[model samples]
Target: MQEEKRRGQNRDIDLDTLDGQIIRALQQDGRASIRDLAASFGATRELVSHRLRLLTEHEGLRVVAALDPGFAGHHVLTHSMVLVDGPVGPVAERLAELPDAVFVSMVSGAFPLVFESRHGSVEELHESLDWVRGLPGVQRVRVTTYSEILKGFFVSPERRQISLDSIDYALIAILQRDGRTSYRALAEAVHLSASSARARVHRLIDAGVIRISAIKSGGISRNRLAIGIGITARGGTEPIGRYLAVSPAIDFAARSHGNYDFVATLVGASSSTLLTVIDELRTIPEVGAIESWAHFDIVKEDYARTLGRVLGP
Candidate 1:
C-alpha cells in the first residue's frame, strides 16, 4: 500500500502475518521473552528479536507496562467527556496535564475531547472536575463514574498481595518505558541480578499490579477503523458490559453512570465490520440506546507512561 499521512500518522508500514502474530502474542503476555515468542512462532530467537525491534522503533508499536492504580493506592476511576466552545488544542493539552488524567484523546463529535482520570476518592474527582469546568474553553463537562473496570487497556483480573518498595517502583519505571527490556539490562538499571530482576517482574505480573502489552499504532487506514461507542441498557448494564468485554472487536469497555450506561471502544477491519459489531450489540435485549464516535486521532495514551511522573522523580 502507498504510504499516506492522515492527521500526522503514516499508514503505509508493511506488516505481514508474522508481524501480526508476534503482536497478538505480546498483547496476551507482554513479558514473553524472545525465546518464548520464538518457540511459539517456530522461529529463531534472533529473528524474533529483530522483528520486535523493527515493530517497536519503526511501526509505532510500544511494549509497556499497564499499571492498575487501584493496586497502587488509587480508588476512583472516572470517564469524562469535555465539550468546549473554544479551540480544542489548548483545552486538550491542559486536560493532559491534570495529575489524575490518564488517557486523553482529541476526537470528532459532540465532545471534541475525551479522557479518563483516577483519584483516591470521590471528593478528589469532584475537585478535578471543578477545576476542569473552570478552564478557559469552559462550556460543559460530563463526568461518569466507572462502577467497575470490566476491561481496561491491558489490566488483568487476577490480583495478588504484593508490596512495592523503591526498587520495585524503579523497576516499574524502567519497564513502563520498555516492556521488552532484557532481564540483564533491567537488573543493571535497577541494581539487581538478572535472575532477581526476572523474579520481580513475574511477581508484578502474577499480582496483576502491572501488565505488559503491545500498543498498536493509530492512523486512519483504508483497511482499519476505530470507533467509540456509548451504550445504554434497559434492564441491566452488567450483561451488556460483559458482552462487550468478550467481543473480538472491543479494545476497551466499562460500565458507567451518566447519559450512557456503558462505554466501549471498537476496532475493526472496515466500516462494515464495525457496523456488524454494533448490530451485534443492538441484538442484545438490554441495549436501549447506542452512540458511536469515530476517532479521528489519538493524541495521548498514558499506558503506564506517567507512572514514574506520578511516583516522583
Candidate 2:
C-alpha cells in the first residue's frame, strides 16, 4: 500500500524528459549558467530558463552548498533505528527537531523511525543517543556508527583538508545558506573584491572542501523509492564497501561497526529496480546477509549545519 502511494507520487516527475536531465546536470554542477545548461541539452536558453524556474519554484529543488564533514568539524556519523512504544508520529517529530539530525524518516520493518545524526566527538554522539533513548514513546534505539561514509547526497567522501581563515569561514557560512550567492554579494559579506571572492569560491570547490549541488527539499528523492540496506560481509568489509560505494544505484553507503558491516541507501524508479540491485548484492560472494527497509515517509532531510555553531562564537 505504501509502495503504491510512493509510485504514484513519483510519476509526477518523469526523469527521462528535459527537466530531469537539467536536474541531473545541476546536481553535478549547481553553479552552471542557464546558457551552459541549454547548450548541453541543445535546447533554447529561454526554454531552459523557464524549466529551471519551474523546478525551483514548484518542484522542491534546492541548490545549496554541502560541506565536507571534516571541514565542518563533524567526525562522527551515525545511523539509528528507533522502535516506538505507541504512536511513532510524535517520536519522529521530536527526532526531526534535533539540530544534529541530518536525515529522519518513518520506515517499514521492526523499527518505525530511522534517523541519521552527526557529532563532533564520540562523547557527543553517545550523549545525543542517550537523550533520544529517553524521549517519550521511545522503546529502544539501535545505532550504527559509520567508520567511513562512502557516498551521500550532501556529504563528499573526498576529504581535502585545507587551511581556512576567517574570511574563508565567512564565505562558507554564506554559501551554506545559498550555494548560488553572487560573487558581488559574497565579496560584500567577506569584504573581498568580487574577483578575489570568485577565486576563493572556485578554489574551495576545486579543493573538495565543499560541494555545490542541487538537493531535493524533501527526502532523498520524491520521484523514486528510498530503501535502506544493511549488509553483513564474509571477509573484510573494504571490498564490499568499495563496490557498494561505486554502484550508481546506491547513493549513500558507509562502513560501520555494528550489527551490519556496511549500510547503504538505494534509490530507484521502482521496486523492481531496487530488487534487482538487491539480487545483485546477494550474488556478491562477500555479502553474507542483507536486511532491507523501505522508507514510508521522510520527515526531515537537512545537512546544512551552521558554521558558527560548529566553530563557536
User: Which predicted model would earn the best lDDT?
Assistant: 2
Indicate the residue-level lDDT of 93 in model 2.
92
lDDT of 1 by residue, 75-180 (tens): 7887788899978989988887887887777777889888888887889888999999999986999877777777765667878787788888888888888888
Q: Against the true structure, candidate 2 has what lDDT?
A: 0.82
- TM-score against native, each model: 0.85, 0.87
Quote model 2's TM-score. 0.87
**Residue-level lDDT for 65 in candidate 1:** 89
Give me the runs in candidate 1 sitting further than 4 Å from their true place.
1-20, 34-51, 217-224, 305-313
* lDDT per residue (tens digit) for residues 123-196 in model 2: 99888998899899999999998988787766664666577788888888888888888999999998999999
Give the whole-model CA lDDT for all candidates, comma-separated: 0.79, 0.82
Q: After superposition, how far is residue 286 of candidate 2 from its true place, in Å?
A: 1.1
